[model samples]
Target chain A: DVKVTQSSRYLVKRTGEKVFLECVQDMDHENMFWYRQDPGLGLRLIYFSYDVKMKEKGDIPEGYSVSREKKERFSLILESASTNQTSMYLCATDPGDSRYEQYFGPGTRLTVT
Target chain B: AQSVTQPDIHITVSEGASLELRCNYSYGATPYLFWYVQSPGQGLQLLLKYFSGDTLVQGIKGFEAEFKRSQSSFNLRKPSVHWSDAAEYFCAVRGYQKVTFGTGTKLQVIP
Candidate 1:
């Protein structure tokens, strides 16, 4: 069984604050992803890391960045959190060999006030 | 670009009734398809996935999905519904390095 753990389940931050969401996977998957889920928008990718120190921007990467200093950990950073950035953030990991089924974390519901 | 569409936004079914959720995709070739379930305030769980082999695939929780090449649809089905089956279902299509998810369908199981 693969386990993906997120640092926080819920968080609250003021506007213009810097926020960090951490994710760790025990499976040592090669690909890690960060996504924000909205009611009508589904899961939109914010950023993804294929390897250590390698990152790519997903569809919506505007105020967000990612860090993958190690193979087992991936972190998502919000440079300047805004009210619009409040969302349910999910972290997922996928082994490159698997058929693209990603294991997800419990998600962090961030509230930017 | 790859995309997935879930037509139904909300569905209501009684316990022991049949269940079906519609999903469609747009891509050049046969892409990886997946169905996920998310409980309230929880993360998404993989129910089933269709990679390459057979058109019909079985997943966890007595759920199954069939891939139709002609229709470009991968619809999920269950023989009988349970109260615990109430959740949000998302259909996803995965390309080489990208995965596109649907808006999801909320299922309500009536007593």
Candidate 2:
């Protein structure tokens, strides 16, 4: 079974605080992705990594950055959290071997107060 | 940029009734389409995908989708919907380097 785990299910942070969301995939997939799900906007990709230490920005990467030092672990960083950044964050993994299917984690709901 | 659209925001169907959810997309070339279901507070689960070949694709939980190239639509259908089938359904299309998803359609199955 392909399992993707996230660091937190729910998080609360004050404005201007730095927050980090961690994700780990057990399937050893080469491609990892971070997306934010909003009410009407659907899932907007924040960033994705094709390989270790290589990351690419997605549709909405303005307030976030990503790190993938190791193959199994990918981290999403909020340089300075803001109220507008509060949303449900999801992490996903693709086999990168032409499978074209992505497995997703439960998701992390972040609240900026 | 390429995009996807789910015409209906929500659809309610009785248990054992047939259901169909509409999805349309605008892609330059041959499109890779996918249908995913997400339960509340959970991640998205792949229902089915259409890359090429057959137009009708069968998926898990007795769900199926038909791809129509002329209409630019891939609509999901189920002969009999169960109460547990209530969830959010998202249609996606692979465009450029990433996959673009629709706003999603919330399915409500009534007993």
Highest TM-score: which candidate? Answer: 1
Stretches of model 1 off by over 4 angstroms after superposition: none
Worst 10 residues of 1 chain A by lDDT: A94-103
What lDDT does model 2 reach? 0.93
TM-score of every prediction relative to native: 0.98, 0.97
Considering every candidate listed, which one attains the maximal DockQ?
1
Prediction-by-prediction clash tally: 0, 0
Q: Which parts of model 2 have CA positions greater than 4 angstroms off?
A: A97-99
lDDT score, candidate 1, position B74: 98
Candidate 1: pairs in clash:
none
Q: Which candidate wins on lDDT?
A: 1
Docking class of 1: medium
- Docking outcome class, model 2: medium
Over B42-104, each residue of candidate 2 has an lDDT whose tens digit, in order, gives 999999999999999999999999999999999999999999999999999986457788999
